[model samples]
Target: MSPNTSAGSKQHLAHSHAHEEDIPGTVNLNAAEGDDTGYGQALFPVPAEDPNDPLQWSNFKKTMILIICSFYSFLANAALIGPSPYIDLWAEEFDISPTKASELISYPNLAFGFGSLIFVPLYLKIGRRPVMLISLIIFCAGIIGASQCTTYGGLMAARVIHGFGSCVCEALPVQLVNDIFFLHERGERIGYYTVCLCLGTFASLPAGYILAGGYGWRLFFYVEFAFGAALLVLAFLFVEETSYDRKSAILMSMPATESEKASEVMGSQVLAEISETRIPPRKSFAKTLSLWGRVDNDVPFFTMMARSFTYFLVPQALWVIASFGINIGLLALAYSYTFPILITSPPYNWTVINSGLFAIAAVVGYALAVPFTSSSDRLAAYFTKRNNGIREAEMRLGVMLPAMLIGPAGIILYGVVAEKSLHWVLYFVGGALSYFAAYFYFSFTLAYAVDSYHSNTSEMLIAMNLGKQYVLPNIALILPL
Candidate 1:
């Protein structure tokens, strides 16, 4: 057969298999008729014919965007949590209680989440690229402003501004993943983003070392400012608008069958008319760089915000929020604040600077877990194959079970060691175990949630950010008390 004929035959077969449904919360990946990316036999939410379809972009372009957004997630989170080592220093300088000083981190963390309510809807209505750019600019400005703040109030204000601005960092990366990647790729890709986000907690280690050098807390913000500025430029240059209206795309329809075509010659004419109406010409690079995207008239911004609150009722979304909150609030924040004080006390008598070294355990934990980032994706794919190409969202969640217990155990270990003044190494072991488990929970739960739900992803993200932020700060505050 001719090469064109072979290709057409394969495409037709792929289309025939595409309409088959898997169990709820799953996708069919029996791409026996299509291209295989190694993880699956087929694609879900199949690519559009337009070259501008994000899934159709070259792997290099996709990787670049992922790298940029992942880096942004890193910076935003680092800026939020990196200041933990400075709580004591700030308290001494500002003549406030340690709790008050910690509030600087806690309150800003709240803003970090609340920022999404505004930006998520704005992106849904306007475009992801523009909102990201605007947020980065605001983030850079806030960082710069923070570095110059001499007063406690001034610094807090600056932190809040940056926190709110960079808040989209949490949600945007996931949205971009949903927009650009295939279902098979989402779990692995989100794992990469989650790794970066988790690594941001390690920033406290370096932040402590910087202050130990007597460079001061403000210097940390200065460094953040520099990176934020660089990231802003990179994002503007590389992150294209991914907010396509798939409903209006012609390729969203199923392929016409030969039998249907044979029934009427006018069927072909009708298909052509539909394609013409649905597909627009791909925009040039320069046009894509334009500050504006065509506003989506169907997106109701306020209604989206209102509906986001309802996602809290979703089991998967609630799980994600709980996973993040417990990890961040009870485990991470608790350890960051307490370890310094405990270690620097008489029994341990470690240098104040060395307190942040506890984050090294976090580093080790995440580094170890990094290799398993794709485990859920692989597992889901495996289960899909066994189920005759039917994939379930629950298939990816089995990996999370081990993490669920491991995290709390580590937290308990840390508490016991701290309470008993046991060997300092026990602290590290506890932290490492907790963080290792946290990695699985963080990466897979979010992936599972996304896979399970096919609704407005941005709204779900808003709900997640809000839920975690609200729950985390209260936990952080209570733990410190």
Candidate 2:
């Protein structure tokens, strides 16, 4: 069992999974003839008799949705962590200590998680499309505001605004994957989102080069603003409301078989069947771009925020929170905060401009891990087949074993290298190895959590956001850096 999953909590989680088909992730993969809409298997969460259903969207449209949301994830995270090298710069400019300047990044990171508290509920209640666009607009406003700020307080305020607004990027992509994709496709698609989210760290590389190019950190925010605006345009055009109600679904008729297709009588019969089914027409382009989208009148907003905290009691959710928090705070931020300080000071002093170079470790780590994005999904599918089409969330747990061990080793190597001031390459090597291993944890833990809580994923995301960013970072900040 992967340490990320709690074996002891299985009995505790029974109530959550009890309502689903047998188990939480369990689904019947066996379909009647001509009913296979999946990978030659039965489609889980079967599509309603409507073109408007997100599941029934065309592949190109689906890909576009994925692209836009993944891009949002990238921009949000880039804006969050890209300013690491500037901790010292901001300290000097604002006449504050480096630790105080770090709060510019840290406070925003807190807002990033806290933003999910409101936005997740908002998206759940109002629909993903409008919430996404509104969030991007808020994010863009904050980024541009940061570009023009001079005081530490003003900049911090702006940073918090953007962080909070953009944070919905994290929740939306995961929610979209669940909204649009089927069970067989979850791991791979979530992996793709994870790669983009990870690559956001790669923003530090360019942020450094911008400084090297004689531009101040403000230009970095300006650059982010530019991309944020462009993403807004894309989102406005393409991201339709994905909130769907499947409770009253009508079963769609299966496609005609070969023998039926060969018969004119059956062909006419199929046409009549389709006509009688009354599938709604696809929304018009103008309508798709409208500000008004889905609204769940029944989803109580504040109650959802209160209930989200309850998910913290669940083991799978806690695992995601702890792992993500440790990776982001202890691993990602530690490197980001320390690399510049170490590189620009005594003993192998390098130019301040090269401080962000360590991000390449993260880039390379995620690159090496990207190809295996779908491995867990494939593994689970294989297991589901073997088990007579009954799928389990734990099936993906096996792939996390190697990463679980290697990750700790990398963390140890990093600590030793930092303590001894070992060769700089070893530091990066540790970062790379740790991050490479973390990529699996980042991708699969989330996939597994979503699989485990097929019904209440929003609450799980709320716990993840709050625990990782709000809860862990505050505790981590108290430690001596």
Candidate 3:
């Protein structure tokens, strides 16, 4: 009582202490007297102090990686679909029915989807680089295997192996782009990647003629094998591991490695105290490749998978209907199946390999889309800022509206031209129009889904990829093709 009363009696001392403690721009709340509503919080939580945060990656670094990965996807997918024009040749050579020979493409596609079930999870657990490198090796091996195969069964097995390996390319790029880019940036970046992917379709068309140019079908696989091997080596050197824990950036600044437990202990204590904060941490290329990152202990893989299923229930998700339907319908079925037959059959009487010209249409379509590649991102960002830093999930949809009409129109035109045996230019024009329209939908819708459902992107991509890929070729495209 003597000491406490003496301190209380020192009014000037107390006032000075109180004045010093009451600093400007500071908030003081009595936790014991009020409910903790977490009113004082950042609008967007800054990433934890992790050097390995994808956000910490430089724009140029991210772009290079994106380009490489997208290119791999383009080559792998091109290799798979490029051989569609050779179906007639396979049928004749193997002495199998065209229906039987078509199984070469269909069965491999099935393997493509299932390969994700293994590789996607493994990438999440191990690191994207390792899985991608392994996949490229397998892809090259499969291509080499296919080049040597003499029997239809052997060729089918080799194609399946290659399809399985290429499957990771689809998931990894979307995942990597998501990992590195922001909400506003996703549409354009994805658009760029989508264009590369679509170009693969065109690139493969030339392979049909390559088969006809005296090199045979074996040359197509051999050429693809060389590209796949080159990409594999590039991936091992460039596509480093991306998994990281963001919480340990502070205590680990001593130029010494810290245990995960120590990092977590300090991170939790500091996190509990900060009401509003900004984090800056040391960065390095090596950190980007570490298989450790900030843990969101709240989320689990199965929970993430479960939550992503709800995206399929969304309206915009459903709206992708006509775009993907028509695009895949035309590329895989109409152009892939029909063009080859039409070009090689009666009136047209074109060579069996000339079926690849449809790919030129695909190329023209994608190239035309180049100017507008940045439009969606810019539009979304503008609208987001106008909304006072609030980003609506649907704002990006505006850019896609133009595409809706464009894609459907292309499909109808292509259908009519094919039905009437119209001039081949009409086919290319219709295909380009349809392909360009589909490009907007692919990039924007994917960006929308990623933004609306920020968590569990990989799982959503899995469902999306598996569902569309399986259903389109099997059901919708099959009818038209």
Candidate 4:
């Protein structure tokens, strides 16, 4: 397909071909169809002539948007799970079973995942910034509602509302990260976000202790409410649209052809061209917020949603499922939930007040593992360079070998400790070891997926997000503690 056949005037090219490798660019959708779009213009996913594609943005812009959105994920997760310590209080006040009280966390968690089914494609279609800002507003209202609720149903509804809104933060950050980052840079960046998301457990330890200090469980809600409100303001002021033309890679990869030939090749490409000539000319905060800043009408909300489901067939997506499920199921759910409950009762007899202290072990473990967070990226990049610029997606998995053995060993030790009533310190040691090992699996799995599937990062993210949600809740509630 020739570039001119696309409907819109060419504003920019796709970033897939921007990297410094050959046989290296994304899978060219246009080239696959044997189009004659200029080799310089072909993009990986091969956007039509639109400039609004998320893939075309500068690294700094993408990074800022990613960091903000990922932090939003961190906060939203914290709000839902942080109140676990207060579940007993809620149970006592409402005269509900411990399991029912736990629903405050579990049901919201389910909502958290399902929310993505609704919003992921919307953001992919409509643009990330607008969806994010709107979601944050709804999230804020949900938090405020939870703070005011006096009944179990009211609180549960509020929690569901909050979880649903917050779910976007999780999926969107990964999607945005996939959208903008290069294969070499993605692992470390996603690792950073995953750290924040995982630390919700560690953060909740102290969140629980706050109740023992007499602030009461309601204070936790208040604290989360305050942070949500602040994050909302920050997002509105800082986030910009992230969707962009998907054609540059295809145009860039194919050899150039005459204009007449290009027109014959691009039958559907013209339909994809965006009408906007410029991106609202990067403006100041006040100007950016004005209703005058036009929204793109070409947003393909439903199409984006429909396409995301196809990620299940991608190999990288399965790896993400295994990596994310094992890491979160083990460290976040199995270890984090079980250790506290076990140590606080039976032979250990530790007080509920101090049960949350074990999260310190988890934090320490992950902290120790932090130095190695970028090892996968470095190793993959090094190997990619060694191959004379031929990039294979599996290069990063070697760095995870050490983690695979170490994590399962920690699990065994924890099981023994719980079964035999060993010293409580063994619990800490085992949990710490598992958490440290999980760092590698959690960090690199995502990088591998991003590198492997060069075209659709959002699709992979959707799968990973859903995987985490399904695994965490099942392990946390159904399996044991």
Candidate 5:
């Protein structure tokens, strides 16, 4: 047995209580006797005694998992959006309409969202590690295939393949966070993931320069492929199987040292009990790499998909879907498509290469918002304390209020400036302001949803990814028309 498991078992035997249901907004700061992480006196989702419990893992191990998963989120998004500047280039090369070429980005984006339908349930039924590894391999294969494509059809297929493969990038990070982190830390950690995710949009700026250097668009895929391969290896080494089925109530309130009749006379009662009562021998390192995951007989595939759709009826889930969809469609895609056309036209006449420089607005905007990423968590914590340790999901929603109007206002500014042919700098000002607010909405809204509902998080993520995909394409179509 590993030292972690050994220690956890001892702790379990020592503690007097099992895990309890969490109130929506409040965290149990003190879960164990003499336990204090400085924030509270209780532990929420009381961790199991098994070393295999993700919560029982050391901080170093948890941080490594977060870093690797966050980077994957970054790469998946960068690959999806990075090729925006290449629409015109692909159009010319393939003798297709720019509209048709733009579909390369659009359709693949749909695939990116829909991919959750297949992968989420797979992870839930099988395990996170194997699914993640398989997805990474598929993503790398698609990237390599795209790098060598000679036709638009070939490229589109490759794009879809990669987009579908990497779609888990959107959901996996959030799921992993839910699995490993505590209630107080979720907001800040999710913020870190959101920052990396937002930074992916900035890839267009570098992609433009890459094209200007005469390396060709295919080189971008090649570079991403190289990174994907490296990440796969890193994941193999660091991303162990996090899918442990914890047994409930494993600790006894009092131990029985004598015969059953004597113990009964002593009035010893059970305090905890988990699913697996006996400690299993630890598997070797090689055993961790085995692709087979324990199949969850209870989680039927189609039923899980069906249940995920019900999250759409949830107000918080709906809010997250709308937030992601509007920002991605209106802010990211709309701006990417429009800036290139507008800046390179008659009055402004910016060179094609320089057109993508507008992405710097996004860079500046997200960078400014980074410090505030933990604001929601802090606000929630404060409210929880004020409420006598009872937390409400709405506690975090306040931080979003300031950013709510800012993004829409920026959109209006961009439109007016474009319509009137105003100063070029106004475009940058508008975009930066909009993206600034988008960061808060993007980060906090999702965090709020997770906090509000303690249901199957993986299923909620599926709904989130699927909802945004459907919403974005419609907006992308309507805006250009």
Candidate 6:
């Protein structure tokens, strides 16, 4: 195992209340005799002997949930970054310097990070479904408000409101993926979520085209509002509450045969099925649609927020913070802040609409990288089988090596080409490569962190999100404004 993976795994094992997962991210992947060998391993987190456990949910249900959350990530981020090309235009309109107008995006972004401080803990308290629904409502309201605002200050306020509300869109998918999926499926599933999140940053391209098409900037927010409203409906219909508290059930059916002994993730010999107690039936659709679900009054809201500060000491958690923050600073910022300025300036004189083409390049880069989304999962599985079912969080990190090298090259290329005023294609090449690398780092490092530490997922996220947004050590907390 890589040092980082070993560290995370050791941390995971140390903190785990269950004995079965003694190795971090490690689980018995081998199926019991007569059971389907699709994953070839025992499920981790040892699903409760209850249908209501998110783990026991059918694939279709899990899939619909993933889709809803992924689209939420897309919708929230598109609105956040989509207005990038408007900096100059807004400057002209507001009778201010481009620097002042840039706050339209920057302050909203700052709010975006700050939102996680509140929402992650809120979800932990009120349950994911109600919080998600309420958040979407806030997001939609902000979008419509943005569309109607004529003053710079009014628009800024609207943007910040939506940004704060939409902030959970980033944290929820990872939380949900961990909540619903098994260890075997996490790396690949996170890939799917990561790709959508990356693509949303490209929303600037379409935003620019909308402006160029003569409907103007406000139309972009209107379009976003329509999409946000539609997503709210889909979320209500499909995104069931995933915050399940799976308690340990008494084991029942262990010795039908030696070969039939199911893998148990909890300590000691346990059966795959539960004993004695009556299992609760699955919630009905109408019940699932109810506004509220599980509420953990025990989870001290403010205390949870305060405890997040401790994760700063964890090496694995810090890696994710640095990885996300630097990528956000370097590539995302470069593309959003600098691309339009460069493309529309002296040498190229391209129209602002054409500046959005940089997003196309980012899309291409992410598309090329998307094929590798499952590579880490497959590679880790392969290595797990080799290691006698002991999977390290670092097992999937090998795939990130290529990305690490490729990402820096892309950053360097974009920077140098911009300095020399060289070919624009080279700049696009740089943007694509940087983001291509970003996808891997974003997905896998986070997976590693969660894999390393079994519980405290919400607190860990609080640390990660806040650290990335407001607390990078030497870097400016927000965007480099």
lDDT of 5 by residue, 164-229 (tens): 999999898898888887666788889899988888867877887888888899989989999999
Pairs of colliding residues, candidate 6: 28-42, 29-40, 29-41, 29-42, 30-40, 30-41
TM-score of each: 0.88, 0.87, 0.77, 0.79, 0.86, 0.85
| Candidate 6 lDDT by residue in tens digits, 121-155 | 89999999999999999999999999898889998
lDDT tens digits by residue: candidate 4, 1-481: 3222323643344323323234433232222244333322223333333334444455556677777887887889888778887788899988999889988988888888878877876776666777888889888888889888899999999999988988888777776777665455567788888788778656577686787677877777788889888887777766765555445433542333233255556654552342222223333557445322224566566676666668767666876776777678777667665776897788888886787787877788889888886788678656655665445678788988888888888889989989999998988888888988888777777777767765566666777777777776666666653
What lDDT is reached at residue 103 by model 2? 91
Model 4: weakest 10-residue lDDT segment is: 271-280
- Candidate 6: which stretches are off by over 4 Å? 1-19, 22-31, 34-38, 92-96, 248-278, 337-349, 415-422, 471-481
Residue 100 of model 1 has an lDDT of 95
- Candidate number with the higher lDDT (3 or 6): 6
**Model 1 Cα shift for residue 49 (angstroms):** 1.3
Residue 172's lDDT within candidate 2 is 89
Using TM-score as the yardstick, the better of models 3 and 6 is 6
RMSD of 5: 4.7
Off by more than 4 A, model 2: 1-20, 37-40, 251-277, 337-352, 415-423, 478-481
Give per-residue CA lDDT, model 3, range 201-264, as digits (tens): 6655577568557778888888888888888766665675655553354344323223324646
The TM-score of predicted model 3 comes to 0.77
Task: Score candidate 2 by lDDT.
Answer: 0.80
Error of 2 at 348 (Å): 4.2
TM-score of 2: 0.87
Q: How would you order the candidates by TM-score, starting with the best?
A: 1, 2, 5, 6, 4, 3
What are the runs in model 1 whose C-alpha is more than 4 Å off?
1-24, 32-38, 88-98, 251-282
Query: How does candidate 1 fare on TM-score?
Result: 0.88
Which candidate, 5 or 6, has the higher TM-score?
Answer: 5
